[model samples]
Target: MNLVIVGLGAIGGSFAMRLMKQGYDRIVGVDIDEETLQLALDKGYIHEGTTSPEHVIAEADIVLLTLYPGQIASFIDENKDHFKQGAVITDVTGVKTSLIRDVERLLPDHVDFIFAHPMRGSEKKGIAGAEESKFKEANALITPVSSNKEENIKKVEQLYKDAGFKTITRVMPEQHDEQIAYVSQLMHALSVSVVNSTQASPDTLLFAGNSFKELTRIADINEELWAELFSMNKDALLDSITCFEEQLDVFKNALVNTNEEELKDFLKKARLQRKKWY
Candidate 1:
């Protein structure tokens, strides 16, 4: 029942905290960020913290990685062989295809690798952003290949549930990436674009309406990490962006032609569609 969580940022820190609160106390955390690791230890999110991946892996029955999309493969390439035999491994990386594909090829047969994405996080970063209930009511997509050990898959699913997540199993990594691109990555790019576009004069900023502010609030983004995710899932994200651009262009044309009827119809349809999700 011991767990090692790598990269103790927002998601990892929150996961560790929730587990400790639930009395799963045998947790060791690993992060390259010294300040974040110290913060996790200080906040009692982790019983221990270290920079050595091998040290952390040696002690745990399960490992949960919360590194960026690009870092996941490199971490596997460098450390998969060292993981304790039969250890259940999983991740919180947003993009799945690349990491899942690489793990399938590189991971030893004895160590199990299951992929997962907890479907929400704040735009905020670091241990300061960690909340014990962050995954409450969040959709955690559990991905286990056919070759994965059935018992281990169940174990990982239980882990997510124990951490307060509502879990859904998704077998195909490619399908996971396609869905995430539209639901997560594309929305981030759209928010970033709007925020950047609206950076006019300060006087113009003061005149912004509530709707404008709400729509573009997520534009305050972590560009470096998101850029990696966007590039990793380029094809899917490009298709999403293109589809959205086409619709936005339709709106643009409506505004130029003073087509109030079409604009109203579009808004009404959008409202109805959004209601379905609620």
Candidate 2:
């Protein structure tokens, strides 16, 4: 099968690298930057590379769009005519509900768009930061709508399985957005807020411990990509933020009132809840 990856950034490049290492040689790469396409080829991540997606869309059996959430629908609409008949198209967009509706409406009847989110990434940026191990040891999620064929769903799931993802869960798009808002988006927001809350100089970081470093690690984020993700899932994320702030108020009021019992109960509940997560 001819596999084409669009927007060969960190996730796409890492996926191509993993596929190449697994002896899949039919991989092609599409990107807006000529240098990036050349870099991917030079690195042996793909057999061929192209800047013009429309020129080669018809050649793809599986087209993986690694573009940002905001770009996925428009990209499909612009090149819908060129996609091969019965081809399976997938994406690595983080947020789902709204984008899924737009893409579902825009896709050609002959093709299937199986929306997904690869639950692995890097604090680093672009193709330069791509690492095969990200997918090798990570979990993935697929949010398929009613129009998707069962065979196509299996094909997409098999692709992730082949890429060495440890788990690939199937969930509805609305559920995906809600859960992701809490687990992924809200965590990133918390990390970003924590980092922004203080003016930490080089000297301050020099004194930081393991927990501090660990919590702020993801603070080295891709601003434009995350901003788009945060906006795309605004309602869910806002709900998550509100929930977090209420919890913060609980701790604050305890501290202000010197309520040791309340603080103890809160810490105990937090520890118990965290244990359940594992």
Candidate 3:
């Protein structure tokens, strides 16, 4: 199979490495940065690397787009004609509603574009940080539009499974966005807010614990990429924040009233709810 991975950043490079390890040859890496392409090539994550997709896209059987959501539409708009006939295109984008709708509308009928989100990543960025282990035991969400062919959707699902994902499930784009708003985006916002709430000092490090370090780990983030993601899913994220604020207010009121019963009940319920995940 001839596979092309666009962007060649952390997630993209990791995907190339895992797929290559699974015995799929002809893996190609594409990126705007020549240095990133060179790093991917040198690391042996891909068999070939290029700074231009136009030259190699015609022969690609599958293309994994790891670009930011905004860039995906523009890239597809410009290179739709270059895609090989019957190629299956997938993505690792975080938020999906607008991107999936726009790409579905613009793509040629000859090819299939199945939207997917591999629910795994690291705090690090770039090809140098790529690791195949990121996908182990992670859930991959396949969000397919009505226009997608069932066979093509299955192919995309199998692709992730072959890359060592533990589970694959399907969801509509709207639900995917809503769930991600709470689970992913809201957590990032909370992490950033927590980290920024206090000025850093030697005293701060001296007093830090595992909870503090774990909570703020994601706060050391790629600002530009996260800003784009937060903006693209603004409405859903705002709804999530409002929900969180309501719960926080309840806790604040309980503390102000010194209601031990309310506080205990809240903590107990939270503990019980969290236990369900295990």
The TM-score leader among the candidates is 3
TM-scores for all candidates: the values are: 0.92, 0.96, 0.97
What tens-digit string does per-residue lDDT give for candidate 3 at 1-278?
Answer: 89999988889888998998998869999998998888878878899998889978899988999998889999999999899889999999989998887787789998999999999976788887788776888899998888888999998988899888999999988999999999999999999998888587668978999999999999999998999899989999999999999999889999999999999999998999999987
- Tens digit of lDDT per residue, candidate 1, span 1-278? 88999888888888999999988858999998888878888878889889988877976899999888778878888987688888988988788777777778887778888888888776888877789999897788877787888898888888888889875666578888888899988988877777777465668667889987887888878887888888889999998889988999989988999999999998999999999999
Candidate 1: segments with Cα more than 4 A from true spot: 167-171
Clashes of 1: 0
Which residue segments of model 3 deviate by more than 4 Å?
198-202
RMSD of 1: 1.9
Clashing pairs in 1: none
lDDT of 3 at 51: 84
Q: What is the lDDT of residue 50 in candidate 2?
A: 90
User: How would you encode candidate 2's per-residue C-alpha lDDT over 1-278 as one tens digit per residue?
Assistant: 78999988889999999988888759999998999999999989899999998867898999999998889889988998999888999998899999987888888899999888888877777899897777876899999899889999999998898888989999998899999999989999989888887676668778889988888888999999999999999999999999999999999999999999999999999999999989
Worst 10-residue lDDT window, candidate 2 = 197-206
